[model samples]
Target: MSFYSDDASADELETLGWYHYDLSRHTAEALLLSNGTNGSYLLRNSNEGAGFFALSVRAKDSVKHFHVTRKGNGYVFGFNEFPTLQHFVNHFANQPLLGSDAGTLMVLKSPYPWRVEEPSIYESVRVHTAIQTGRTENDLMPSAPSLGTKEGYLVKQGAIVKNWKQRWFTLNRYELKYFKEKACEEPIRTLDLRACSAVQFDYSQDRVNCFCLVFPDRTFYLCAKTGVEADEWIKILRWKLPAVTLSVSSHR
Candidate 1:
């Protein structure tokens, strides 16, 4: 690899320019690179280790994701092991064969330029202000450990682009974990209730069903699928950090 990062090894496989889909220009959370005309792409995620790569190809009408890992300056994709990146690159180097890749062929070759921000959940969700007297919620609420789970899409800050992207969220106990897709076993990132600076309900008034998780370093702008879900998540977060204020929407 060509200097993936400090953690990456120089002796490993060939490098591909991974195009990031995020709006942020800082971090490299998602990397995708394609020939533009070809549907195939070389992918990498900063959230994942440097050892892994996702090779996506378009076959017929369906797109496929193939898991590959770096091995001794070579690549092991799916079940086949290539001794060098050149061999793997050669396997899919044919122009006709590359055109079939689904991931990039359309996006790169489309007539219309792709727009990242459209009218979506980020626009639909509204944040409310808290009605608490002080910075603390009363002790009468249930604890974070008892809050259980909530399923929704959360607006997450991008690692590279510094923009926000919607991620599938699961609120379990004192933890909030977000994933690239629903039902994924591994989370892209997890937030600790114990480490949070404060949990504010509806801290931003622009969005409905919106809640904010405050931390010393950063803040999470999250919105539940519904107001009830947002309230429940805030209620649970308050229990974990008792001093955190409870926010109630004026509409509710």
Candidate 2:
């Protein structure tokens, strides 16, 4: 369940060489920025949600994540839509993609090739595809262990500034914690999951994949990199709610 469930389809995509089935947003950014030149690009499963793909390209000194939205059986990146990924690549190869502000032009010069011979490709693809498909490893096969904890990067809104900053978040059995960075020794804050009344998606926010953690004192807003990631986090947190509530009842 971690990758495309259809073996034939996945094998076909693998042959493209530019389709990286297992790359995460941050990992993609790191690889493209550190190893690739400007215009170096690759395609991967979008964190946004099911049936979505992302275009990660080295734009200027940094990498930009663009969701290639599905449109009426076709796919779109910018202004134009293509019938297939092959056509999309062919069209963009000659035409330069306009920068966000229309200031610079980015050409698809090189493709960050896929490593077919890598030993980890199978596992990575499986996990990633499962995420997109909204199924855990356990769901795919009973022998697979259930996920007890979830950790990833999410943008959190500050209480005072109301501005968003990406933080490393961790959710466990008893509490949820966020750190300023992934390697930080201490957490910025921790919320007892027992106090969390509910976790729900907040579509009111002017962003995609926004969710709210409802606590008695206040509500915390968080934005995940992709809709699928947000949904998974919400699922795990909600799953913990019943146990935490039972613990409270036992104490009473």
Candidate 3:
């Protein structure tokens, strides 16, 4: 069964305007959230397995704008306000240009070996994991025994896809393939959604949607939905997590 089967009811497909892909070590989860208002999509990868990366796209004056972020380390890349290509070049000198086609451009870092490409307006910005250290055994499997639902989360596993000494830990062999497969999914073809904010509040009906999760080192807000009722949904999510946390934690 699909991971979203049980929580399908909780998800309002119509409200999910654009497509967002969450790729971890084990599985890739996609969601259509809000419209393309906030951004085209938000992409995340798992740090435990390897790490996470995200892309946000927005439209400006008929041209699509892109923003890319790496979750844990917080590396951000996007177009600058410079008017000419030379301006972009002067700033990021060490990076090598990957490709430029159909009004889109691609670049890569020869050192970290990262790939940055823009495929389209609504579908702009793609980031591939780089081999920081050397190669290692890498594999992608279900995070847990069972699939996860929107209501239930899953833990995925990544190990050596194949056995080899030199190519074992090299992220280029397996990790890149995994990320591309997850990122290459067809982006939602609409333009009416936005990203849910990390923090939000609603004044109507005397209720507020404030949700926060405290990891050992950091805190995250999992609430905030897309569109007009986003604030309200944030409140609902805030109230829900405490109970949900206990339930999920106990099981873990």
Query: Best-fitting candidate, measured by lDDT?
Result: 2
Better of 1 and 2 by lDDT: 2
Model 1, residue 202: C-alpha shift (Å): 4.2
Q: In what order do the candidates fall by TM-score, top score first?
A: 2, 1, 3
Computed on alpha carbons, the lDDT of every model, listed in order, comes to 0.54, 0.75, 0.28
Count clashes in each candidate, considering only residues at least 3 apart in sequence or on different chains. 21, 9, 26
Ranking by lDDT: 2, 1, 3
Winner of 1 and 3 under lDDT: 1
Worst window of 10 by summed lDDT in candidate 3? 167-176
Q: 176 in model 1: Cα distance from truth in Å? A: 1.4
Error of 2 at 112 (Å): 32
Model 1 lDDT, full chain set: 0.54
Error of 1 at 82 (Å): 94
List residue ranges in candidate 1 displaced over 4 A. 1-147, 159-162, 202-205, 242-252
lDDT of 3 by residue, 136-215 (tens): 42321211101111111111122233221111111111111111122344422111111111224423322233233333
